[model samples]
Target: MAFPRVSILPLLLLLLITPFSSSLSLSDTITKDSLYQLCSQPTIRKHFCIIWLTNDPTTFTLNFYGLLGLVIQKTQLYGYKNLAMMKSLVRTTTDPMLKIPYGSCVTYYESAIKSMEEAIKFAILKKYELTSEAAGKAFSSINSCEADLAGRNTVPSDVPLRNIRFKRMCNIVRVFSDVLTAKNY
Candidate 1:
């Protein structure tokens, strides 16, 4: 009984100290729980969701610095259905103009454009106030992705799987960028 009491004391102390060790900072985006409470207010919920949604895209930029690990975590939470579709399209396409095993790298590019367009629309409608320049920036990301696709496709060799993956990852980083920069979100 004495030994068990001593052991429990140490365990309890460890648990208490573990939580207090973390530092709080404002650069941190507001928490989901708090955001949810804000959302319940009716007037602010849409803006709240949109703001969080928009913040997701700017995550991939060269300048991205805030809460890097958390940003990735949120993007994962969003679950890239579009990105997965784009990846599958790129992986399967064999022709550039028509359909073969896939359409080569262009398939991914097309999917990206489609996805960004939808994301912009999402921002403009529910959280229009949350997005940068009111979805204008998100719109521009589509064009930038297009330009990037053109460059990658032109550059050179047959689109390897690695190349496809790299384009898929790097270009979508802009999604987070547009979101974060968007004034409303």
Candidate 2:
């Protein structure tokens, strides 16, 4: 009985690709888990970190820089939303004192949003130090707004609490930026 000849080229190619493919998949799993672990580090809201980081399908493939960009964008969106809410409150409020605080809160949110935008731009430019600084500014603005409201005991209902949560998210981003810069990741 005679057997048909099998091309050695196909077998050789399979042998060459198998290890690389397996390693690639293994690396992906490792990255995903490690990224999740990293998110849990500084943020008090572990669930929020996990959900926010994992909600986007593209997040699993993102490096630290890309994750920082995503955080900046989300924080900016939160700031804008809070700004609009403050504006609405200011418009509808009857108390002059409330108007002053609301107006100030609006300005703070706007400033935070701007800083977040700057952070995103810096991240895109691969300037991690600038990105981290901008993010810190954004975080400070959020905290300032919350502090101002709290000092006066006139927080816009849930705005202070929301700001605290947003600050935590920004904190996570900022910490990652610092770590990545320090370690040259």
lDDT by candidate, in order shown: 0.39, 0.72
The total number of steric clashes, by the backbone 3 Å criterion, in model 1 comes to 18
The estimated TM-scores of all candidates read 0.24, 0.75
Model 2 clashing-pair count? 0
Tell me the TM-score of model 1. 0.24
Please give, for residues 1-185, the per-residue lDDT of candidate 1 as tens digits: 35534557887676556532132222455455333332233222345344653466543232222432333334333324434544566555554632332343344445444544544554435343332232233334334444445534433243343343333332333333343344223
Q: Over the stretch 1-185, how does candidate 2's per-residue lDDT look in tens digits?
A: 99999899998787556533232222233266656556655544677777877777767676555666777787777777778888998899876777877888888888888888888888788777888898889888877777667666544558777787778777776776676576554
**Alpha carbon lDDT at 121, candidate 1:** 51
